[model samples]
Target chain A: MQYPEAIAKLIESYSKLPGIGRKSATRLAFYTLGMSDDDVKNFARSLSASKSDLTFCRICGFITSKDDDPCVICSDESRDQSKIFVVENSQDEMAIENTHDYHGLYHVLNGVLSPMEGRGPEDINITSLITRLSDHSEVKEVIIGLDASTEGEATTLYLARLIRPSGIKVTRLARGLSVGTNVDYADQLTLTQAVNGRTEI
Target chain B: MQYPEAIAKLIESYSKLPGIGRKSATRLAFYTLGMSDDDVKNFARSLSASKSDLTFCRICGFITSKDDDPCVICSDESRDQSKIFVVENSQDEMAIENTHDYHGLYHVLNGVLSPMEGRGPEDINITSLITRLSDHSEVKEVIIGLDASTEGEATTLYLARLIRPSGIKVTRLARGLSVGTNVDYADQLTLTQAVNGRTEI
Candidate 1:
């Protein structure tokens, strides 16, 4: 039986995901066939809804369901507003949250500095970070919690230099994490250690 | 800055794809930010299109874009209608087609018989296949071109036994495929030899 063009197209789209080859994509496409029309519609709706419902927090750049300008992290009175742990992305924020070691808020750079990939400090939200730091007088500590990769190191150095004039104590995650590993892939114990052993730049 | 709720939701949805994990999903989700609104809409449309447009052909059970009763392979007049190469799914049909080795048609069983997975002969299109054999007097050969896995072997045995009374030749792909390997993952040369040297059961 020939699948309709739309089914084939969806299979192709599923195949584009990492590790999902053509065969698996077809399986997933067929799985969708078993789904109720309403369920399938809901799944498709969720795909677009996620893109439209979520927004980045303006103050710390973390992803949140709300668009309240400051987000929960920035607005929460309990969170340590004086210290900001800078991360490469929201996944890192999730990883750090899983560890439950850090009480301070987070700042997602969105990406690291990768010259080979043509990604510079300006390519991400470094300017916005600097602006946030300059605008907020309460923030005293800026911890660079980027990955331990070459790009992450470059980004760390760049951000440290950029934020030093603001008189904030710039620090980074400790050397416990292996080189070339992203914070998101790190285990809970390793992440906790990295957070606990943060050092001054 | 935190991504909008819609963007975060899209990233979460992307993460559900096989092998995407979280970080890659985020990257893909954010990459969509660079895409034009039309492109994003098109991506979503293609996804739903694949689901809504395709249907399984009633005769050969191969997936096709045509809405006509039987798929192109089932309706074609010039092809060797006497020989039918059975496969586990439509992707397997494509894999065999990529080699340009077989001109005969295909019968997609949808899946192999795996009792451990609670998949019996009735679970797949075995009944339809029996009906097709009894209904069509022209079919001369039934080729068991399934995977080389345990389940594939079980399905092949079940099919061979069931079709023995049909007075048609029942054959399987030669042992060119490694045991426990899927036909879809096999190299072209191996699969070609398997198809070319198929022996009667």
Candidate 2:
């Protein structure tokens, strides 16, 4: 009782996506079948267009249109170029930018150093970041805004060791219990950081 | 601080799918971008191809390729043409086929009677089913294999009322508590059906 070849192929394609299992994929395939021909074309086109039409920003590694190589953040003159926030990827950059508190430009590393996963310093987009820092003497500080994971910590230390020798101030995102998280439920590492990094009210 | 237009479009498309929300869509969009160009093209091709290449079986309403008008079940000479299992959609038809117990042909109603949703008798693929029964005097029994919803009950009653006058037998799936379900935890309706439909071993 196998499904038709088209349905089976579409289900397999959908199942490749994160968080989608075979059952969910089947549901998606059936739903796609119900869509109008125009909608189906647009849906399929978007999958390919999202990948082909976008490219990494040459200067910052943030994703942008193929025509915008330096990206909007790097080209904007009003942003504080002196404070460069180095994040793990474009999504992290977006999350930070959404806060609207940091008016500094960003540098996306594309990925963190994961030695266990065979991802090392060379695997990520680090060379361009170093070159950007050396080229812009106005950039006085490098803020490592990576996740609070082992790989993020390793990447932060690795970048700090490299950038600090050039007389540039190096810092990292403040580690503490997240806002809206109950103190009782906070993990041990976060609680310890919150205690150690206590500031005046 | 918007995601690139292509990325945003892909995310929107993923979000439109059932069971996927904004967070899941974002994750899927990023995963799609990470896929190889050939894989992405294949994935997109499957979406459009599944929609355009497959169509409804003209006789049974089951989804099939364009060339298979009557579908595999309807055209099979070995199957019992005298008994027809009426289901809501192709998914149900597949589910029933998976059991490997029934050898009768199927008639897909496309949808059940959902008057609350403004769906009437004409809204679903019922006309063709009635025409098939009228055209084939060999179909002596009609088995309603719809879901156990109020709409399913209404549709079963409606179909039985129409086909019973033709001197054909009309039956529905047995109603009772499912196997392995805890009797203590069963809902009132199921418990009631279990009591009413109780049988001796």
Candidate 3:
């Protein structure tokens, strides 16, 4: 009445991921059974290699190969060193980098400061940002590109207040109604932020 | 702008499974990076072991560990060998077993006949079922437990016709309005089936 031991173990592991529940995990495990042997081997190898072959950049906290310490963004001297676009994760850094709009370097905070979850400033990569900033006097501005949630807002404020005393410029990513989003359908918070942060053309 | 090579490979592997898109894959891959070394190792080991440590039951076509051929259900002699529950996958077999309502053995077809998709009798486990039926005179009846979809219905009817000639009784799972479902909200097809299959209470 139970799944075979190997299958049950795989299902349990798959369910450990975010958003994947018991049903989804079961479905995924069965699907894996149907996959070609080569694909399964590759998938298994990739899972192992991700842990063995990858490490976080010490300065920026971005993911990189184990051999590379500072990551490509940090090692590149051609990029702007004066501004550090801080985000919650490397995925956000990639999203910004994909746009080809910002020429500055990035700093990954790994997570937001959520007091509701007992995640304080010390829990995330905030102190490293301060250290990186103080160590490099050339770094002029810190862009607090955190989420628009309450936690993000609070973290941005905390970082801004902490950095401004150093006489270095501190700002946050602008909040507004998203592009292509209908004004009538936009949430109250989004509309309020758009109105409050209105700019002249 | 792309993810680090190892991370990208892991994300690609994650997205290969059902229902996981690029964004979800990226999130899962990053989460894997955050998991402990031991947990990641276990996940990788499970993935490899699923393929290496398991095999299909030769008789029932259900998943079982490599050393066990006919699976637990087929090998059990105390269960009712007079009836067989036929299903499309091992997951379906597990679902029926979880209900604890049916004590009969199960036969997994692995897939249903889909003529629209060019799948015919030869593609699925139909021939094996026929062989098993003729091999065992004790199997007096076969209960078709496939899904209510078009392919399932087709396979059920096809198999019923194929085995009924040999004087073997073939029955199908009932089709009616599900328990606790709002009848008024049920679709027209379901209503029609419910009306057609009504039994005097």
Candidate 4:
């Protein structure tokens, strides 16, 4: 009374994604079967391309084509070379990029430090950021734009301590109430940070 | 800024899955990128294998290996040849098979009648079901195990009308308040059905 071997394998693959369980995986696997032959092939191609065709930037650790090792951000002379915006993931970089608020170059940390899981600086893209800074004397500042989670804080503190010795200015992203979040619904820690970091209009 | 071409393609591919929006697709695509090369290759292999290495059963319309045309259940000599349990999907068939209460072959309709979606009798696996019934003289009963939704009811009614002329007994799954459902929380229609179908136990 088991699903066909191919379908079961597909279901297991789908289950590996975040937020997908066995039931959801079954739903996804069946739906995949209903896709056109071209679509199925294309989906498979995209999956392989995401892994095989893309590589981390040698300079900034962001995702780029296999041929573009240093990535466009690292190579772009028009961007602000004096500042590097460091993030835990490329999605955060995209979030900031979409806003058109920052023009500096980027450094993807890939992941945050999590001692609970035994993930340390060596496990993420931290080494490359240090190397990039050391190799580029024009860089004046490193802006840590990691998430506001405990692990993010730990990574930021570690990175700050690591970079502060070189006399290059280092700053972490501001922690306060998120935009559009109601004060009454805000958590205690956020409210305290909001009060402590209030700026005059 | 747009994501790199490969990552963007992966996101679009992931977005095609059920219940997965652009945000969730982005998360899944990035997660796939983080997977080991071997795991990613296996995931891609499963996606392609689900399409290439498997096909629908010629008789029951259930999924099977490419080489097994009629599928295991349809070809099984041990099962009850007098009964055919009709279901909307293989998942429904698996749900029934898990209970070990039924010992009949299954005919997967692939989809139920959904007029709003422009799906008709021809759009589903209905024609094959009729053909299977005509070819097999031993099938005396067809238990319609479709969902109890409007579309399911429509399909059941359509199939029942179509097969009634052949002198075969056409039955449907009973509708009532589900097991473990609280009486007070049951919907009006379920309560009505439960009352109307109540029997001495």
Candidate 5:
């Protein structure tokens, strides 16, 4: 059956997102149609605004709204800069931040090492992380806070092999986190447990 | 955690939809940020286009992109004007059309009768439906194709009580369809059974 071109277009856009199927997309489109004109305008405006407003912090690679070189995490004096926890993405950054247990700063890798997905050490911010380590001798420990996936494991191994010779302590989040679970999906208690039970590599 | 105003706005817009939680909205906002400029433009365009391009058919209340006074269903020579099935929304029209079992026309109520929500016969297209019936003397049977919900039951009773006085046969889709299931969610076989086994109201 044919739908209005506008409705069809809206449904198509909604379906483009991850996990949203055609039926769900159509429902969303109809829901939007029922909304007021102001709401629809706000929805459209936000779609473009998110891309233009948010920026990756230059110092720590964490996503932040500020245009300053150092994000809130990097600039905060109370946080422990000596212990840097490296994560796979910004979502993990939020997860860890929610626990209020991690007083250390974060370095987002953007993605894990995955040869199958054509992702490698060079493709990520590994070189920059190494440079940061060399430049900042005060950093005592480097915690690999990546997920428990195959790529997370490979990246941990690669990072450990590179930093072990530097005489800096390299650690990883504990195995308390279940296999196949992404760091973003983990609950606060599980993430806290993993952080507290970290093991030296 | 402070997000950029634009990102926050985007997340808020996504949270307005049904079933989408804060986390899902954030994920969607990030995904939208990663989309290409053309895709973003297309999405925005689709929203406005659907709203502006489609018009509700005056005769049947079905939304159509056509500029014609009566929509395809109302104007089609092949369709049996004598048999009209009334539905609550346009999606139900699609569900019935998918089966291709009925060559009859449709009448959309825009919504079901719900006194609790302050919706009455006048709030929907009930008046227009009455006008259509009075104007079309050739019409033989009127089928109420509403869901088995409280509002649907109310609308059916209201319509049955009103239309029975006109001396024309009034019928409803059969009891084969399970209660609380929307017509759009019903399978083809179940919908077919409901349509074929229709009884006098």
Candidate 6:
């Protein structure tokens, strides 16, 4: 039988999310029905509150509470202002931060250049990064830490061309075989990068 | 850096879902952040509406809009009242209905007996089913269409014992190897069931 209107609507809403298909959406909607009233309210409230309550950092374009405009990273005095890591999104920034090797600040591009999808440099937060760089001469290095995709390469090239004229050093995350990955399973591109980026023993 | 309160809240909420992990939850939260304001509002509205605007069918214990108290299936005159198919939840009922073979009514048990999880016959909608059966007197066959889990078996046995005393024919879904499944790959229990439930060609 067809789901009731409310359940169907919720399923539709869930299916619109990334990585969630119609079947998973239906499962999720049914799971929601089993949730307590308070939990359901909290879940719904969080969905709306996350969008309406948070503000983007003015400098880094990272998400932050409305009261903290530049976000914790941008506002913190301990973070190295001399280097800025440019990433595709806040999740990427978080991933880099989790590594604990980089103490530099971050610039969230929000998305990469996907011309096929009508996503140009203007579509993302590139302008903010450019403005931040131009306004602050202290940022000596701009590290492009994007995904290993066509859009990422295009965005990196675009950013390099734009930032190179300003005398700022531009770099990218090393594209090599990832940790715990078997050499036999490594793709040709990764193998090539691993050989190209061979470090001294 | 720590996620903003709103983003963190959303991720936590998403992670609470059955199949979603922390990484998937984070991805979903980011996707939510990228959603248009109207879309986000609608999503949140749908979540709340699905919880608040839906009610359980009084007769069958199935989910339905608040206005449709007995639900479509329970109220429909075309359904064969002589047979009541018992399922663990609304999703199971939907799955059975999708097959299109069952023209009888349904009785949602809401959940199966799981002593480990503190769920007993008293915890679910079994009492309502029993009440419906006794009051109606038309339900001749009670089909238990629960999952092939230990909990499902226990519930089915319990239900069979309860209904047999009332002189009602209690049946279960035929358990065997699934269609198109290779016999070699089938589990031992499934193989056993397949052998036991063998039919004459």
- The candidate that achieves the highest TM-score relative to the unseen native structure: 3
Instruction: Give the alpha carbon lDDT tens digit for every residue of A38-93 in model 1.
Output: 65665576566655665677777777665566776778889888898999887788
For residue B98, model 1's alpha carbon misses the true position, in angstroms, by 2.8
For residues A39-118, write the lDDT of model 5, one tens digit per residue. Answer: 88887777766666678788788777756557788889888979889998777888898988889888888888888989
Best by lDDT: 3
Model 2 residue B131 CA deviation (Å) reads 1.6
Chain A vs. true chain A, TM-score per model, equals 0.81, 0.95, 0.96, 0.94, 0.84, 0.93
Model 6 backbone overlap count: 0
Sorted by DockQ, highest first, which candidate order results?
3, 4, 2, 6, 5, 1
RMSD (CA, Å), each prediction: 6.4, 1.9, 1.3, 1.8, 6.1, 2.6
A155 Cα displacement, candidate 3 (Å)? 0.2
What does candidate 4's lDDT look like per residue over B1-201, in tens digits? Answer: 777899999999888877899999999999998888888898899999998889989888898988878788887899999999999988999999999999999999988889899999998999988998999999999999888888888888899999999999999888787889999999999999989988789
Error at A193, model 3, angstroms: 3.0
List the TM-score for candidate 3's chain B: 0.96
Query: TM-score of each candidate?
Result: 0.79, 0.93, 0.97, 0.94, 0.82, 0.89
**Which pairs of residues clash in candidate 5, taking residues 3 or more apart in a chain or in different chains?**
A6-B50
Q: For model 2 chain B, give the 10-residue run with minimal summed lDDT.
A: B65-74
Q: Which stretches of candidate 5 lie above 4 Å from their native place?
A: A66-70, A75-79, A177-201, B66-70, B177-201
Q: What is the full ranking by TM-score, best candidate first? A: 3, 4, 2, 6, 5, 1
Task: Indicate the DockQ of the complex predicted as candidate 6.
Answer: 0.70
lDDT of 2 at A200: 94
Q: Can you tell me which runs of candidate 1 are displaced by over 4 Å?
A: A1-4, A18-24, A34-39, A177-201, B1-39, B177-201
Cα-lDDT of candidate 4: 0.90
Give the C-alpha interface root-mean-square deviation per candidate: 4.2, 1.2, 0.9, 0.9, 1.8, 1.4
lDDT over C-alpha atoms for residue B154 of model 3: 88
- Compared with the true structure, all predictions reach lDDT values of 0.78, 0.90, 0.92, 0.90, 0.85, 0.91
lDDT of 2 by residue, A1-201 (tens): 788888889989988887789888888888998877877888899988987899999888899989877799989999998999999888889999999999998999889999799998888988988998889999999999998888899899999999999999999988887779999999998999999999999
- Model 3 CAPRI rating: high
TM-score, model 6 to reference: 0.89
